[model samples]
Target: MNTSHQTATVSSKDGATPPAPRTRRRRNVAVVAALTGILGAMGTLVYFAVPLYQLFCQVTGFGGTTQVAAKAPGAVPGRVVTVRFDTNVARDMPWQFSPPAPVEVRLGEERLVAFAAQNTGNEPMLGTATFNVTPFKVARYFNKIECFCFTEQLLMPGERKEFPVTFFVDPAIADDPNAGDVTAITLSYTFYNKGAAALDEYLNRSRATAGRAVPREMNQ
Candidate 1:
């Protein structure tokens, strides 16, 4: 009887120990799964953070990003400020670019500025422009109504085209203490070739159109 009791007790203890390891394994698996889910979520957020931040800057004019407006500021101020224009082109882009000399205008007064571009390349090309305003702090107050930077430009070889930018400084800028010392603002632009894909698409369309058209001799 004593031997039987001892065997029974040992059997009970062995059975209890087996369940404990299984429970521990289950807990460990749950922890690993939870950690993996958290890391994946973080990676997704990081991927989307950049474009979201840029949109926020463009909308709020934070970080010296300028604003786009449909119309000029309604009120004009007596204060006069000088606006200087700057232009640049990428080394790979075969184009001559020029900006007009500086001009002075009253705050909230609309001014139209022109930039000239000529294609020096032997082939027709498409280009796009990017622009920004400086004294970075003044970007929020510098408003552009219309600008060529809004569109892509196509120029044939030896072709020259003039682009215009209409803009004004918000009269409310004077209310900001940080802008008190600001006297001059510079608008700068740089042009780059659009891309091979755009050029190829244009060429393909031209070829397709030519194929469908009847030659003048055939029509006659």
Candidate 2:
């Protein structure tokens, strides 16, 4: 061999270092394990996404889910807010659902509202109601002490029932920056066939589990 070629050859003891095959294999295994963990976590999230999202909305009033209260803090002395109502019956429900007319309510004052429902079908049917408020952000301050929507109703043919909703605008709404300019809120409800809205009924169970009050937001 030529002298120049011999000098060009590098050995580990002379500071020439090569990558370790074992080290490379260990790195690959670590990367695969990390990737697998990440994918598994994402899959788990996808599976629980729906119930979790609804639970989140119910707690935060996001998506117009209103607050549930045991009683109204005394209505703001002279403050009044206009509340309008809307109602709907799902297709093929065979029921007539109507909400009360717009009414002026004093902040912190308890008010009783009623909705009329009649079963026109030939057979008795069970229905449940889903409700929301608009200007959706105002939902948190709209408190319902008691509402028929909280339970399922069974109506027999030709039976007419009046559903009661007892509620109030939390006096704190007047103090909230987000609700400062809110002069009116429309409460809406849609009656659905119990089987078609089995998912929505979960909110009721969650409410019961959460008890009298639910925090507005959650980290999870």
Best by lDDT: 1
How well is each residue in 1-36 modelled by candidate 1, as lDDT tens digits?
999999879989888543487888999999999999
Candidate 2 residue-pair clash tally: 3
TM-score per candidate, in order? 0.62, 0.58
Error of 1 at 206 (Å): 6.8
Query: Over the full model, what C-alpha lDDT does candidate 1 score relative to the true structure?
Result: 0.88
Top-scoring candidate (TM-score)? 1
Q: List model 2 lDDT by residue over 40-112, tens digit each.
A: 9999999999999999998887998754587887767777899999999999799999889999999989899
TM match of model 2 to true structure: 0.58
Cα error, residue 116 of model 1, in Å, equals 0.6
Instruction: Rate residue 215 of model 1 by lDDT.
Output: 79
